[model samples]
Target: MILHIGQQKSGTTYLQEVLGHVAGPLAETAGILYPASIREVLPDAVESHERATSGLLGTEYPWISAERAADERAKWPRLMARVRAWPGTALLSAEALSTIRSPAVARVAAEFAGAEVAVVVTTRSLDRSLPSLWQQHVRNGRVSTVGEFFDLLARQRDRGPAAIEREHGLHLWRAFALGGLVRRWAAQVGPERVRVVVNPGSPPDLLWRRFATAIGARHCADLPSDDVRTHRAHRGLTHVEAELVLALNRAIGEAGWSRYEGRAIREEILQHGLLPRTDRGPRVAVPMPARKRVAAWAEEDLADLRATGVRVVGNLDELQCSAEPQDVDQPPVAPEEVAQAAAAAIMAVASRDRYAPALRRRGWRARLGSRA
Candidate 1:
């Protein structure tokens, strides 16, 4: 079994999309089973843990509930049953799996005892990952400025590894400290079975080739690498756009939107509305002052991974960020740009709400006319 445990923002979304695209063809050719809905097979507890902390918004986010627990319990057996039915290697993925405790890892290992299980972890340099990670937090309702976020990280770093794990929560820390994450999973699965793929910042298809190698799915070479979805893939929000989102999140929270309602705003309004606008602004990046620190942390992480004896799939140097820091800090995004993004997002949500009823009425009218 091939398990892709995402360290997040490491082209994981793209990889999952590719895997979904090739599920049938790969199964036919290589006896590989990348199910269309891989998460259905993971235990409910694991799912809950993922949902609770994946956003890096802290554990008080209120996503956990009895209803979700029941649903997850139901899913675990269904996943196992599906795995049992599949005749060949089964592929399961979720970035949140990186945060699972050793006991949960043991449970997953036990569930697939008869199968040859290998864990694949995708990682990138801290320089790349920090900005992406912060942008994700923005998407998920973080209101902290980039400077503030880094400050939190710096303070957490000073408190030691356990403190970092405790304060930032397991999901965020694991993502940042890639080697520590590998160690956690390797303890259960063994270091040799863990495949660490370093993300070189070019030729988008490099990650796929390395990932396919890790999973024994060389047949994926024949599958189309281009993202073929009609909708634009999610991109990092521009600095101004992210600031606007933080304001919206605060408004939504103050208005006391329910979890479902908040998600609708985040996904429908922010994700579909603001994220697709390529003309929005420059992609967010780590400020010059923070780059050196990020690079040092990355070097330490690489050293840890080297010590573990896990299979490294790409050039270790590609994981290093030795670039000279820019002289200026990230420029303050203009208020005008933030206003424009906010206006566009508001309009998108308004348009959807305005047209929805008309579309429903038209559907009803057609159905009634057909009866006549």
Candidate 2:
């Protein structure tokens, strides 16, 4: 089985969507089973398994509620049952799986005991990834400014690994410490079976081809190439849009809105409503002061990975940041920009509702005519 454990922001979503679109063809032609259901089941299984084992070990994981833990634990056995039943090489992809502790990793490996298990980690340079990661946190309701986020990362880097694991949490640190992540999986799956694919900046097809080769499913060439482009890249919000969302999150909390309502506001109002209209602003860049520190860390990580001798698909140098620093760091979104986003969001919702009653009436008439 091929298990793609992601260091997020490394094209995992795009790869998953493309794989999902061609899952049937890939199964038929290449004997690769990337069932659409695996997309849903894999993350649940990983999370549930992690939570269950963590509970047994008396470890506390952030955001894991008791009810959620129990629910996930209950769902895991059924998910593994599906995996055990798969007839050919199974492909499972989930970014969350990257953070699974040693015990959970062992458990997952044990479940696929008889099969050939290869672990694929898709990685990007720390300098490039930090900004993207922060943007992701913002999307999920983090309110920290870019400067504050980098400051936290710089402090964590200075304190070293133990502090990083303790303070920053597994997801954040695993992304920064790529070699350590590889070693954790390598200990169980064997270094030979761990493949790290460096994300080159261009010729987008390169990552998928390398992944296909790693999984021993070269016949995946039969799948349509256009499927990759059809899925939109998971773009991060512009500075103005993100600030607006952050402010909105604060308002939701102060208003004592229910979880459902808060989610609707974030997803429906900000993501769906405002995001589409916002221009793709400047790509997030590592703060100028921290660029050197991030590059140094990236160097250390690359050296460590080299020492471990895990199979690396791309040039190690690709992991280094070569881009020149920005002349001046972009400032926070102006109040004017925030106001504009707010106005756009309101108009978007209003426009949608304007047609809603007429659409409902049309649907009702259609249903009545059918009955008559």
Local distance difference test scores for all models: 0.71, 0.71
Q: Residue-wise lDDT of candidate 1 within 220-281, one digit each (tens)?
A: 66575465322123467777787888788788889988757876777887666786676788
Name the regions of candidate 2 deviating beyond 4 angstroms.
Answer: 38-61, 162-170, 201-203, 225-227, 322-324, 327-336, 351-372
| Per-model TM-score versus the true fold | 0.81, 0.81
Please write out the lDDT profile of model 2 over residues 1-372, one tens digit for every residue. 888888888877767766766778878877777744434656422121233333322223455666666655644465456667878787777666776566667877887788889999998877667788887787787778877898887776677766544552544665568877888799988999999988775666676777677777766744656646344456776666766777777787789888678777677776556767736455677877778778788878888899889998877888886445665346666777678788877765566667768978779757867899
Q: Clashes in each model (backbone N, CA, C under 3 Å)?
A: 0, 0
